[model samples]
Target: MYNLLLKEVRLGVNPFFFVLPLITGALMLVPGWLYFIVPLYFCMITIPNIFGGYKSQNDLMFTSMLPVNKKNVVQAKVLLIVLLEVLHVVTAMIYGKISLSLYPHLHYIFFKPTPGFWGLTLVMLALFNLFFISMYFKTAYKYGAATLVASTVAVLFAVEAEWLGIQNQFVSDLFKGSGSTDGLTHYSILFTGVLIFAAFTFIAYRIAYQRFKKVEV
Candidate 1:
């Protein structure tokens, strides 16, 4: 499993993706920007490109020919996705801190780049993994439909969350107003988001493994 993950990091993924976090994360410096788009870049660019490469390089066939089982293959891929998502969000979080420091008094119309906001980003990515993994495993080669559907789910989540944050006073207070100032609340949201992410990924893995098992490849 470790070696498979290493293979994914060193070979399966593109070099550009390694530095993409740096590029996208820098956008967090833009004060009061729609920070969700920072993480959304991964859903828009990385997943499709990485999976497209896998398909073009005949990765499914090659990996299937190896000693590893389909479950491990799916697990490694899902882990890689999770790792990349962390890279993107963590980098953005760092930059977000810098932004917060730079503009201490800036008012935000959207969600602040707080731990809670990053937590919400994790949830969005979690939904992406759930849809993408399950659908991709249906063929284990074709990813267009999986990517489209999953990306849509993620976008919808971001939009709805932002909308609620804007329109709902309690929601706004929790993420943007006084609630944002409360360490316990924001951290709790972050913790809950992490748990949700784990649960969603586990479910995605189970569904993907089952689907991959049925694939002729």
Candidate 2:
């Protein structure tokens, strides 16, 4: 499982992905900026390309030739996806810190990506991963259409959510405010988000396993 995960990471995750957070982090210096959009952008641009490439390259066929179970292969792919998400979030957080330090007077309208925001991001990504993995594997290797559809739906949902938040006062408040890094609510939300992400990820893994099991390649 570990070896499979490493292979996926090497093949799918790349330096461009790592640089994305850093580039977006720099944008945080702009006052009242919506930093959360950074992660969303990362998802929209990269997830489809990476996963779609995997399908086009017949990654499953190559991996299946090895002495690994289909379930483990699926699990490894999911794990690699989760790891990439983590990398994105952590790098953004570090960038947030640097941005704040450089511009102390900057006023952020949205929650400055506290623990709660990260939790929210995790939940969003987990939901996306579940859909992307489940749908892509059903075709047994045709990711282009699946990826395009999934990415479109995910981007539209995110845009609509942001639009609604802008128009609704209560919804806007949910994402507003800034505070010190120490807080119980922040930690609680972070933990809860992690659990939710784990649950959804496990669900995705099961779906992938069942779909991949019947794949002829």
Candidate 3:
């Protein structure tokens, strides 16, 4: 399982995508910019590119030739996706810190990233990953349509959530009112979001394993 994961990480993911977190993270320095958009863009570009490329290259055929089980293959792919998401969030956090240090005055415009944002971002990414992994594996050989649909759906949901004032309620309060980290009820939401993401990711893994197991290649 570990070897299969390493293989996928080494062969499937582009290095450029890895650095994207850092690039997005640096956007925190921009005055009056929405920092959340950085991570959203990270998800938009990376997930589709990696999974879509795997399907385009017929990666299952080559991978099946190796000794790994279909379950491990699915697990490895999901693990890599999770790892990438973690990388993006951590890098963005670090960049947010640096941005504040460099321009203290601009800090007032940008609320310090709290646990609430992290929790919400996790939910967002997990929701997208569930759709992306499930759809991509359904037709592993033809990723173009699946990738487009999944990516579009994820982006639209995120955009709509922001536009509808769902994602911003906490942030808005933090910036406009006396919302403190201690006062926010993010831990419960964060815990719940983590559990939901884990459940959905597990479902996605199972779907991938089943689909890949039936593929002739």
Candidate 4:
């Protein structure tokens, strides 16, 4: 299982992608921006391209020739995706800290790149993975429809959250308004959201694994 994941890091995923999430992370430097989109951007671009690399390199065929079973392949690949997603979030969080420092008085209709916001970002990506990986593996190579639909769903989640944050004064205060600096109380929601995100993504991984295991390749 570890070796299979190493294959993805060493060959399946392009070196450029390891650096690519930083581009999305760099969005945090843009003060007052919709910081939530940074991680979503990571999903929007990274996931499809990683799968594309797999096809271009004939990864499915090559891996099938190995001694590993389909379940381990699915596990390693899903794990690779999860690791990359986490990297994107951590990188963006660092930049988010910088953005806060750069603009201590900044404000936005969208949620700033707070820990809580990253939690929501995780959920959005979870939805994307639930749709994208499961649907893509059903055919094992066709990712276009899956990517399109999944990305759209993730975007809709962000848009709805932003819309609500804009209209609901109390919610806005919690994430984007004055309540931001309220310390532990302000971050309680963020921690809970992260935990929820973890649960959902774990479930999504199981669903994707089961679906992929049924594929002939």
Report lDDT (CA) for all predictions. Answer: 0.92, 0.71, 0.71, 0.80
Per-residue error for 103 in candidate 4, Å, reads: 0.4
Using TM-score as the measure, which candidate wins?
1
lDDT tens digits by residue: candidate 4, 31-88: 7888767877766688888887777888888999999988788788778888898899
User: Per-residue lDDT for 108-130 in model 3, tens only?
Assistant: 44344556556666777777777
Clashing pairs in 2: none
Write the candidate numbers in order of decreasing lDDT.
Answer: 1, 4, 2, 3
Q: Please provide TM-scores, in order, for all candidate models, with all chains considered together.
A: 0.97, 0.83, 0.82, 0.93
* Residue-level lDDT tens digits of model 2 in 140-209: 5776666666566556656665676577776565555433355687677779989988998889888888
Off by over 4 Å in 4: none
Q: Whose TM-score is higher: candidate 2's or candidate 3's?
A: 2
lDDT of 1 at 15: 92
Better of 1 and 2 by TM-score: 1
Highest lDDT against the true fold, candidate:
1
> What are the per-model numbers of colliding residue pairs?
0, 0, 0, 0
Estimate candidate 2's alpha-carbon lDDT, on a 0 to 1 scale.
0.71
Off by over 4 Å in 3: 100-112, 164-171, 174-176
